[model samples]
Target: MIVRPALCTIVLTLVTVAVHAKTPVATGTGGAVATISEQASQSALAILDRGGNAIDAAVAAAATLGVTDPFSCGIGGGGFMVVYLAKEKRVITIDHRETAPASFTPSSFTANGKELDFDTTVASGLSVGVPGTVRGWHEALQRYGTMSFAQVLAPAIRVAGDGFTVNDNFTRMVTENTAKFSRFPATAALYLEDGKAIPAGTLLRNPDMAKAYRALATGGVRAFYEGPLAQAIVDAVNRPATKAGSAVMGGAMTLADLANYEARLRPAVRTTYRGYELYGMPLPGSGGVAVGEALNILEGFELGKLPRAQAEHLYLEASRLAFADRNAYLADPEYVEAPVAGLLSKDYAAKRRALIDGRKAPTASVAAGDPYAFQRDASVPLRPLPAKGKLLREGAHTTHLTVADKEGNIVAYTFTIESWGGSGIVVPGYGFLLNNELTDFDFTGPHPNVPEAGKRPRSSMAPTIALRDGKPAFTVGSPGGATIITTVLQTIVNHVDFGMPMDDAIAAPRLSQRNGATTDVEPGFAGTAQAHALARYGHRWSSAPEEIGAANAIVFNPDGTVTAVSERRRHGIGSALVQNKAH
Candidate 1:
């Protein structure tokens, strides 16, 4: 494997060693505040202290997240943001999801009617979706933020230009995933040097990315999509090596695709469970419908009265049904048919709920309540399947941030490059990683997720905002791909159903059901019998590290103070700042 020196190795090591040696001191609180990554939270709190609104704080935090958490998110990737504008009493969903190239088609990765290996299909240029993070942020600022894009992006540019101390989590991720970076020359040159990975506590800078951002600040989103940056991306994709093999590495993502990409605003999917109204991303994102269906299905059971094991069974059953429907019917509504109403309907949920046996696990392909006319097309033509295991096929490592201002405005944003540092391909002179999100699409033809021109790839991004008694009460989201919906669903349950505090709710152990696999309980789970019982149902149990998905949340208490918490498992540190409160 090729190893390269990270620009920040030494500084990162020293800083990490020093920080670990000392106890962390609690900081920040009351009227107006922000919390995210340790440093990003501080930056947002500063913005709040300066009289900036929630939008301002969120923008600041997001920009900071791009710098300190580069592996998960950056301007090069795309995402979704749910904004609650208190003044207008409007909750808008920004559908900034990545889109497919105009030349993309269902057979893009197929070889003689067979599906290619998942990794081989989605990791290269063929899998890249149209990026929208920049456009989403820009539109958000233009609509509700008090500060300009330049002002909000200042912190990120400063961090990238002046350099920042790398943290332990980032250092470890870089070291472990170094092989991915070596595949692309530009990526290797930017992230590594002299054949060694950057170590912990290194001081790293990204002048090129900063310069690109500087131009963006001056010229808006167009500067990146229509200017020299766009040309660089096109050139890089078409480089000889990018097309040297039969693999679909380089194709037609021309300057036009970049220039034409736009971030659209849509209505948030709204559903009521118990007494609270839940809102999440819709259509292109199955997270909202899937989570809503799970919640609706579990509502049929008395989770509050059941034993912990029983509750786990109920959760697993609901997850199975939701996921089955997801694979069968969910896709970009702009390109395919999705059973949104039928999937989320209470009647369908109840029928699916009845399939759970409680005493034992169902077989791998147990039937869930099907939506109207949902056919099991066993005769569908087979496409070449990629030769990768589920573990390797799973995409993750993204950043989530929740922000709320005194006026009741809120923003929940989730961003990513669609894998650890994306495909490890960095565009020369851009200094940011490009998303490998195209892998999210099925390379096999006849699958609902097959790629198509102008199609938006399905995403699990569920940036959400909820209103209670007609006002913003909670803002939450996570960054775990397929697990994202599960994490957010459980968090909401812990807070709304169990009445846990925001911190405790987010801190709760999370379990995920991915592609028929049930991940065992994470840290802080109080039950093992449930895990053991799950094994009896033909379910394979595996332990996931604490670094799964980091969930961040902020809740508006009845008294008006905001409680913000970040997941500790991912080494997440959150801050609470109150406006006009004595320090």
Candidate 2:
């Protein structure tokens, strides 16, 4: 077995408070925020309290996450944001996924006539991609926000300077990445104390990160992509700050790559499920297409009328089918011709759904289904299927935040740096980790997701906003690599088909089956009656139990109030707060 570095390790710190207790659910009338950290949720709630719209509050919370939950996400990474515009009566999306540098090639991860070991590339600068988080945030604020970059970034800046109390999560992440972090002087200086992980409850200050935020506040996006900050980033990637004799591989990133970076406003992926319109991120992120396909497959069944176990069996089967197509066809649209319209077509879903046996799981592995016949543009020929590519490993990390304002505007955003400490190389003086996102590409070629110059790697971030009868229904998202699709899909199913409250839906146990031979079931679901009933249907579970995803959601009630729900068990419980609620 290949033993890899702990890529999913993440730290969760509390802002100003010495002790923290996460409130996983909150309900109020005006506005609400839910995230993995208390400080981030509070930061967003404060913005809403100050009369800022959901877009403004989302930016504030995301920025604050950089300070309190550094290992999960920050300005060093990129993400996708789905926003609901109450006045415009439309949903829009921002695609800020990191792109490979101009120097990259299809064979970039290859070495000595073969693909390099996955772990070897993980912590090296060779895995770094051009970051887009800052640009994405700037675009969101400039186009849809009521506040300036400085205004939204104030909370993060203050938290970074004031210092936060480290918790067990913080110490655990440091301990897991000690070997990698120790190799870099800059990374070690902050996370490690004399080559050891800092103990829990210790007050950790990051003046350097505060300085970084201040620079962006004054210099704008240009400061991050062109000025001294850009230079520092390029230097860090090209010549990583490694200790002598460590022999870490540096990247080929250049100033031109950084300067050329820009976040885009892409059309959201739209589909209807049970009369509700679902909107999600477009290409370069597979969440929407995959989730939509699975939902389409499930729509044929009356899950509400079926036995709970039977409904769950179908859900798992649908996930397996959707993932087969996702892995086979989805990639950066600029590099590949993915038949997205066909993939999400109801006709195609009916055809795929026919393969599921209600009484049993597929005894053999499922193959990708053909969707070209349902393509809107029938003239486009089907591309020849290549041999299956190596599964690009993704750590179950990253972060998701949801916010809604009194205006009815809502934002569901998910962002990441791709691993615990990213490439585990901290930029000298910048106090942020560069993303190892390029590793998301399939290492070998002759495939859709192969590495190429300026190509954006496909992501599983499904930030979703659903609407019923032209009004907001709910907005949901999660952070868990490939399982993100299943998590979001299941949560929606739990609430819509099974008639659970939003909080109960999120708190429910999860099962992730991504075309694998055995489904990965959470411990909470492993020994239950549902598991046994499913087992009779030939459904096998992974030997080891795994928590699937940390998902957050907001439910819009018929009464016009919003209920924000966070994970009650995952990521040490999450924080959910509302603008008018005193709790």
> Which one is best on lDDT?
2
Model 1 segments more than 4 A misplaced: 1-36, 121-123, 240-248, 373-392, 515-517, 520-530, 533-539, 543-546, 572-583
Give candidate 2 regions above 4 Å deviation.
Answer: 1-18, 386-390
lDDT per residue, candidate 2, 1-583, as tens digits? Answer: 1111232122324245556688998888898999998989988988888889999999999999888888879888899999989999998999999999999999899987799888879889899999999999999999999998888889888888776777888788889899989888888777886688877876677777888999999988988999899999999898887888898888999999999998889999999999999999999899999999999999999999998889999999999999889988899998888989999999999999999999999866688888888998866786567335234588667899999998889999999998887888888776788888888888887788989999999899999999999999998999888889999999999999999998899888888888888888787676888889989888998898977888999998897677889999887789999877633
Give lDDT per model, in order.
0.70, 0.88
Per-residue lDDT over 243-270 for candidate 1, one digit per residue giving the tens place of the 0 to 100 score: 1233445556878888889888888888
Worst 10 residues of 1 by lDDT: 19-28
